[model samples]
Target: MLDALIQQSVCLTQHYTGSPVCNPSRAALLTGRYSHRTGSLDTLEWWGLERLALREEWLLPLGGLAVPGDLDHEAAKEDKEREARSDVHEPSRPSRFVSFAPLRDFVFQPAALDHYAATALFLACVRRLRPDFAPTADDARHIARICRLLEGMPLGIELAAPWAGKLPLGEIADELAAGLGLLATTLRDVPPRHRSMRAAFDRSWALLSVPERDILRQLSVFRGGFTREAAEAVAGATMADLSNLTDRSRLRVEPSGRYAVHELIRQYCGERLGAEHEAEAGETAEQVHDRHAAHYAGFLRVLEPQINWRASINSEVGPETGNLDAAWRWVIEQGRYELVQAMVMGLYHIAVAEGRYQTTLRLFDAAVQRLRAQRGRGEGGAGDAPTDLLLALLLFCQGHMCIDLGLLRRAEACTEESLAVLDGIAPGRLREEQTLYTKGLVALLRSWQGEFAEALRLRGELLSWLRTTEVSVWPHVPQVGTLFVQANECASLGFLTWHLGQYDVAQGWLRESLAIREQLGEERWRAYGLRTLAGVLRTIGELEDAERLTRKGLALSEAHQDRIGIGWSHSALAATLMSAGRPGEAQSHFVESLAVAQDSGHHALLILSLNGLGALALRRGNLDEAGQLYEESRASFERLGIAGTLRYAEAVIGLGEVALARGDWSRARARFREALAARACRAWEKMDAVAGMAQVFAGEGDTSQAAELLALVAHHPFTAHATRERVEALLAELEAELPAEVFAVATARGRARELDEAVECLAA
Candidate 1:
């Protein structure tokens, strides 16, 4: 069965030496004889080997024998004839024979002992023989070179051992570099093939068929290792071809099912290919690289969506990141801009989502530079809608990333350029569709920068366009990602209103968008909607509903690994918990939210989280802690160009409360005044500021002034039960401190003050 298996294998090279010496082992194997029967128990008695007794149990060797000059065929023939005459039946063996070379495996590294024993023993013999030599450190380095050249093969080490004794290890290493020609042993006992390393490799090379040789040479192009699919694409090799190479040990299939060639063998194969295609002048090598680049470029696209949708960022795509990088390098170097664009687009989403800011920034910058260069050369943008759209999309993505980082100026610049590119393209519904979404982004950025009036105007325009325009006119392709801009349009409007403190109205818009996203099966956007609506709910005294919505959003964010959504949901959840009087739970969520926001570089989200934490601290009467948190959050909002926004209004209120706790009544009034001055603040937020100033007035024993501010707060809906209770306590206190006629007059005077006059009252 073993003989049959050997016959079926494509190629097999056997060097079985049952007697430990070449001549004796050859005599035994060729004549099917045991060492005792052959009278070759030792190497010294192997001369003129003939007449060996056959072992009945021994199987025939069925592969070709290529003994290059060591064990001569003439000697084997004499042994066969002697065996026939000695009444020993000739063992059945394959008749095919060829001249070939065998490349030896390297086992020189210290770790190699785990896999190879013969090479280890050879090294042991060398060390023992040279005990008195006492080579220098540099000489030890040269010894490593010598080992590499001989690939630590048992025969090669044995042959090179004599030179190591006669010359310095460095000189022996240099001589080997001139190939086996100069390293040949002059001893008459050693065969010519066994004298040098090259002879063995040459003998192995001679046995390969043309197709097998071609496959081996092509496989040298791969770096690291390659999958079978990659091998088939880049090397133009089939499974059967790889299997044959693997069986012959020309290619090694790793346990992971990847194929790899030994480094030395790869170098040898590269040289072989270079020699064969000298006339082609490296053209074939270039083609292989191109195929490799193309193959991995496609691979990036397949894994792109999963990057933001799952936590497989480190598992599935992480390992292939090197290959994708290689592909990008080649594409960029070769000026394959279209491929570069595709690769960049595929990787950018995951890169940004994974918080690989530096990588994504570099890739985006490179892509834009390349695209501009191509356009300069008149190689692109000549009615290339797809490429133009892709370019615009990349700019838009960069703008969004900038927004996350709170770089509103840069965000505006990117979105403006994206919009310009879209406008520069041919006029069409698709262009208009993209223009509306890009406009919404610009508006959102404006809103982030505290330009509420301008932002609301621009967003309102986009909302109008989306409402009047039919969804059928928009591009139906999956590349649109969100498909309908209406959902996002509504969500953006909701967010803007949320900043304006119209919590009740914001909740409706966000809910509408959430329902639309659910119908569209856009889970990522749905998470956004849930988080936004939760913030609105939290502000409007709906703690339980806020917690539920925020938890749902947090679950979705975690499931999708959307760090931005996760951060937002965490802050919103923290706000709900803080309002529910769960300070400890709220503190942890606030910390987690801040950490996530900071790591993700979402400055806008960070502002909200910090403010939430500050509010919680204020509620717990940790005046110093709340003051620090609120001031830091205020600085962030201003740094992001979003000062005076409703978010900032809340932070101002916390700072006022901090002042009130410190008995700095005048400073408390000033902070409250700052929030009341922002006319865009929601009625409830303005009421909170007014109520705070009332507390300051009451602290100063001015019951009449306190009654006026308290009356203004009484007219609006109370968002926080704690704030409402505080206001009621102050109102009752004012009523008890003053005469009924005085309290009634002050309350009526506060009620008579116009909303703007009331806000200006604090401002004045």
Candidate 2:
């Protein structure tokens, strides 16, 4: 019939299935709005047919219904309960008058419903039909689950709404998972087509040709959706087959031009694929599986660079993550170590960078489990250089993700294991370049763990190796030269040295790295180098230059949509602004940074921004606000198991500053000591904590100890900044209180003492 219409010069337009069942779909078609709006949400009841039930053949344009919001909030709970019961109490209300709630009523939008408007519509209609329903919090959640299980089909909602009265929402949802057999209706007046969800799908399925059926079955392997290119590769589906399936309402074309099938239809196709095909029992299945896996693997590998470096990485690659997972599972089953390694490496770091930490960890765990299993089976045993290399690289990637998640102990374990594996390989047998890469990662881990001297030593060694390593090809980033690796090493070395108070040397190394990245056209890494150098400049009191570099880095990251880059650059720029005494502007950038951090779930970036906000709050004398911010940051760091890091120390010390302001001498001293004891405490943070402790001593009438501690930090650059005015005033007051000779002696001894010696004195 569709072919006949096309032959007769008919134009077929795209539309939603309206509702999953016939009666509701017809009512929507007749009313030009949603089933709920027309008071025809049930499959068996003929909606709008009290006026007309003609079967004339004229052109019918079925406009799609807008989806409803996911009602999971407290207000939404009240509104949904009220709305659900409205139909039972107010049957005389207009079709649209049953207290329908808008999206704003929900506590928050569920992430899954962000795209599926049709699903939201079905959920609204289902909620409306159950006017007498009351539910617990868990039952309220089942609304989303039911919509998802039914794939937002109207017929499924119609069938499930009745069950809401006798059984719990969860039970109805669970029954739907058992298949369409549970969704049958007993209404005698309804058309046979609308009697069951399966009946509607069966009519369409029977109209398909053998090729169409095969393509549809194969396409069911895709989880979310698939592009034309993916379809052709994985399912051996041609454009014509897709068009036919689409025309027959067996498949859907999303606004992004990707194709999708309803979950119910996909399940049906899956069953057919399992039952009807001989390939499932033989070698042909392997070929099809290989093609499907290879298609997604290649897709990820091609986009790996963008995924790793861009802020828009999630939007670009998120749609295909389901397909990627499917590919990984297939390769794992086949014990294909090489493919598994490629798949994990391609997405793991990018996933972490985008804040999908749990997902990336799962990927790492699954791949590692497979690798260990292969080793136990002797497939990955000794002298298999390829498998060994794959395992080592996989472990390295896993460690990198662990670092981002603040799993410092887990990170070290994985990275050390990677190093151990690399060391076991004969020196000349393994690739020299990959070995250097692992060593570089270990250096980074050391830096994050606050072993500054060791970090600098390892990073310097990496720089030396990077200078001599030759590369004919730079994977993924072809335009980046061998100096790219050296440039990155130099940046790390500069940051490490800067933290250790070697400013001049840090400047030289940072400048050289930035110059190299710019010359090589390494845009993303160039942004990183700029932000790193900007931080160094900020530390050295070169505020103008620091602001300029940070601004450039921000612009570059904004252009590339690199969230990590944007976040880091924003932090650098904010700190620079704060140092320049522009607290208002700095607060704005910190707010932006916090928003981005929360959105991306980037723990490290979030901590930095929160600390910055706390610092700003302290300066403004909003002691309570500063305390709250610092406490939140400390809690997050502790939760992520990264409380020993320098960032967490800053938060701890900020809390001490608040305590000092509130005149809580004992509490201030304790908090300052806690900050000082953190292994990750860097020089500036240590100085800040010491200053806060000195203030506590002054408050306690221990002027001698207070003057000595104040003298230790008096010559530091922090004392010159506006942020330290309070500490500086306290020092002046203490200086006057002490005898001239005592003041001079204390200052002289402090100036002569090394940082470690001062720490020891404070501890005493």
Candidate 3:
């Protein structure tokens, strides 16, 4: 699994700086500095270890292993003999013995016990707000990470944590107590670490009064982060009880106008209820999760809009620009994302209806776990159409999540298994169509990510398949996902074309897709659609309009707190700023964009931000800084096995500019030529390379060739841009190579801008 996580991961050289010892090394490691700097000193203690007989039960034995150094000691002989027996049983069988590494049933983070303590405190507040129960420290962290994704929930983790101060968290999580069957536990299962909150939650729950437990029961009705009104309605008690809860910090109200209960408490309440009234509790939990899921699905719907805010801005007396910040706030800071995280444990209908395809997958994983638990009691939640549908839906959703997470091979396997299951069933119109729709959507996503080039062909084939299906299949088919897929394709292809400098062509596709999104009437989505349009507008130099459109998109992204989407808008704004010669401001925006990529670990945007940073540095006359930024971007590109073409070539051009600044003509020419050979693909940014190449030729006394390259720049529709100072400088160098008479003629012929304009030109 660690290797799987590392698949799409790109490694970069990082310098190490910390202590090299054991115990004192922890201090240096924690501070990311040496013990000398951190004031930490060495301390050593012997840890006793001796293997004992009769301690091999799953949990006990895992914690009991105490082996001497490895050179195939006595204990290893039993395993070799077993392999020898297996080989004898099947003469052709290859030996499957691994001499060193032990196969384990569970993986634990030995270095992170302190981290677990910190995480528990953070999750306690969340546990207090939730209705069902408080989870273990481990579950609390998972919940917190998900909750933080919602815009209104940045402080969410602190709201839902559990007590870890009284007992071992593993005891509470009996289901996970197997520890690792083959790996030795570094610490005793019972220890001084047991005094933390993970143990305290169990004690606290046991201490709750019947009245408090009853109040908790009523609280379970509400799912996710709730409103103050919700607590008042569900708590089934007087105003004094509500006040008491608030006074005790058991309930918290956020500035975004939502109320929350701690998740650890919710987990505690939920676990007890299962033993007390199993069937009823399960149904209630399902209901709460379903509603929670439904609310956030609303957030997803708004992802495709292109808002018209000019009316509101114009209606105001002040200039429209001042309202931009306010508008940004109104659009982005909404409470939509909280429900999305709750959806991870939500009911099936909400997931399907909301088109939260990605989250649905995550929720399905939780459901599978729950189902297994239910199975332990000789019961099954699997049943009729809706229940079965949800199950199948979850399988497909999980498959898609794997795909988006960049496990393409695993994604394919999961989706295929899903398709096989669906095929075994009797056809229902909506279900049949949905299966196909999701399949098609994944195919297109693969295409959009530069993984598959035959996307158009595959999409066309899916469309053809849809047409072949009967209208009767409409009831089962998924329409929303399919519609979005069309919109997505148009948007993705539109950007590609814009990059290729075909603005008009790009606009055709973007406008059509944008119009569809506007008609969809989902505010967030319309905003997303307008983003695509803004990109097209910017390419054609409609800076003011592009700014407006992009802000609208950013608002939608913020309203939903969609990290992936928000980062994209940041990049969009930064690019426009770059073109407008606001590199200093652009640099800040690019940095913000890079932060978004860092948050999601999305490779595409991370590299894009680096490139943007490099360009901004060049604009600011910081050549060394530009080179570093370019080098950083190159490292990302190289790790991903992609920069050898576009990004690498662009970085080479940036290097050439740096060399030119130092009067290194030979190096500059070599860099420029090297850049051109690699710049085989179309990209508007390639203009920088062409312009630099012209400068190189002129520097080498190749007047005719330099003049031709300069002419290409001079005639470029975008070349007259106020930010083309670098190209103008290249043209000036060409002029120096020509005779005075021909230069005059060329100047008259508009081969050069008016000298004043040329002198005033700025780099784009």
Give candidate 3's error at residue 635 in angstroms. 1.8
Q: Rate the local accuracy (lDDT) of all candidates.
A: 0.62, 0.65, 0.45
Residue 143, model 2, lDDT:
59
Model 3, span 149-267: residue lDDT tens = 21111112221222223234333222111111111112243222223223434544555566665556555433344455444544445656655554444454544455445443444
State the local distance difference test value for candidate 3.
0.45
- The candidate scoring highest on TM-score is 2
Over the stretch 531-616, how does candidate 2's per-residue lDDT look in tens digits? 87877777656789989989998887776655566777788889899989999999988877776566556677888898899989
The order of the candidates by TM-score, greatest first, is 2, 1, 3
lDDT of 1 by residue, 402-450 (tens): 7777676787888988887787789876677667667878887777556
Provide the clashing-pair count of each candidate structure.
7, 9, 65
Q: Number of the top candidate by lDDT?
A: 2
lDDT of 1: 0.62
TM-score of each candidate structure, all chains considered together: 0.62, 0.80, 0.53
